[model samples]
Target: MSSSVPHAKPGGRAAAGAARAASPSIIVIGVGMKMRGDGGFGAAVIEALRAYPAVVDRVRLAACDGEPARMIDLWQGYRCALVLDAVRGGSERHGFVYRRELDPEVGDFGAQPGGTSHAVGLGAAARLAHVMDRLPGRLILYAVHGRDFRLGAPLSGPVAQAVPELAARIGREVLGALAAAAAGAGKPAKGG
Candidate 1:
């Protein structure tokens, strides 16, 4: 789990079918800086996800460029929100992926403001949303640890290799969430 991608299942077809089977109510928010080396993890995930046309059609995907305000608006009225971002200086090594829930009760999964300079707005915006009572019911963050954040840089080798697997994980999680929601509402899960 530390060295390789977890949940190594192919999600392209399943995700596409799931998207086509129901209304799109899940939002995946990808936030990153495009030119800042591995800091562009969110954008990479979004780019990778775009390959599934059906999923793209049914799910709301936003490459927020680290703007938490935009993320707030993009996820409004959505059933679930999945956020991706890059962070540095964490216990996780470069290219490490961290997935955690942001329940309304627990606040922010122990995430502090300014975890990464680029992610400052994200933490703050989450607090603002809490204050304004605008948070989605289900919020999760899939954050990747970044090595280089210099301008005009590309993702390092490890980070680049991890993007596809991470994207697949995002798809699976989104589909699962949609399925659970459908089940809770007494409807069959789409594409299950």
Candidate 2:
């Protein structure tokens, strides 16, 4: 429900690049499964971002089912990548959100649960990308705790409520990256 969504969405590659260089350099990727309960957090957040006017205009957006290769490919050229996904296998309460900026050490990810919906999880994706040198300059992950993953079930109550909240936070991060790119900030992506 933010009133500050940007009015214009940047067009395809050529147009987006010519019109705004930063738009292509920054990518936002949402990963999840819609058919399972609470597995749709990533997609839901992306949907909220799409409806918001400010976000789509300033960056590249992608939705994926947490497939490792596809995930790496989508973020290739971008300098900064903000990835959103559902997480399970942890003690965290449902609807809890964890924000972690992974380090370059591809070996140890500290057990990042990228949800049970995928065969290989997101931490594996990052490691693979690192091995192939496909990682963007900065890769930040926002993981939402999932309560259920039964196929065809709807999102849990807490997860349903968390969708918009996480979306707004991500929207702000996108705009901040846009601003930094615009002002020639040229700052390192410690937390971009």
Candidate 3:
């Protein structure tokens, strides 16, 4: 699933159609340091998602260079927040993933703050959100195992492969969240 380029660019028309009105209810954020090898996984996955406009136009998308304050602000008022980043030092091998929900309900946010490759990563942002009472209704993190953070190096093989998979999964997440919200509001989901 991993590669530098998006799987396809044929969705240009669909992507263009995403210019419809209405703010998105969910925000998908990719947090990473683009200059560092696998450390840029978050940003890479975000680029891959450009292939899916149905998902793109339905949600707010952002790429953060691992700034805690900015990250917190991006998800401030959204109903749901999804974070994509790379991590290290887990019992699992390279490319292993950790998915957690940390919000009104804890969904096993068990990974240590130190595991992240970011300098002042989501852990600090989560802490800030906790203190400020600014967490979204739903907050999820998809952290993929990685290494080779050497500057100017491209993504590690494993991390690159995970990009497409994460991109597609995140697309599903955006759409599904919209569907759920529509059902809750008793209306058809926009652009579904």
TM-scores, all candidates, are 0.78, 0.80, 0.81
Identify the runs in model 1 with alpha carbons over 4 angstroms from their true place.
1-23, 111-114, 187-192
Candidate 1: give the clashing pairs.
Answer: none
1-192 per-residue lDDT for model 1 (tens digits): 011112334687576446434646777877876788888888888889888776677677777766666677666566678888888777777788888777687446675322754745566667777777878887888888888889999998878988999988877777766677777899667898
Predict model 3's lDDT versus the native: 0.77
Model 2: which residue pairs collide?
A: 5-53, 5-54, 6-53, 6-54
Give the RMSD in angstroms, all C-alphas superposed, for model 3: 8.5
lDDT of the candidates, in the order given: 0.73, 0.77, 0.77
Q: Assess candidate 1 and give its TM-score to the true structure.
A: 0.78
Model 3 Cα lDDT, one tens digit per residue, 4-106: 1123355674653353224576888888877889889988888888889898777777788778888877777777889998887777778776688874544
The number of the candidate with the highest TM-score is 3
Instruction: Report the C-alpha displacement of residue 125, candidate 1, in angstroms.
Output: 1.2
Ranking by lDDT: 2, 3, 1
Q: After superposition, how far is residue 46 of candidate 3 from its true place, in Å?
A: 0.5
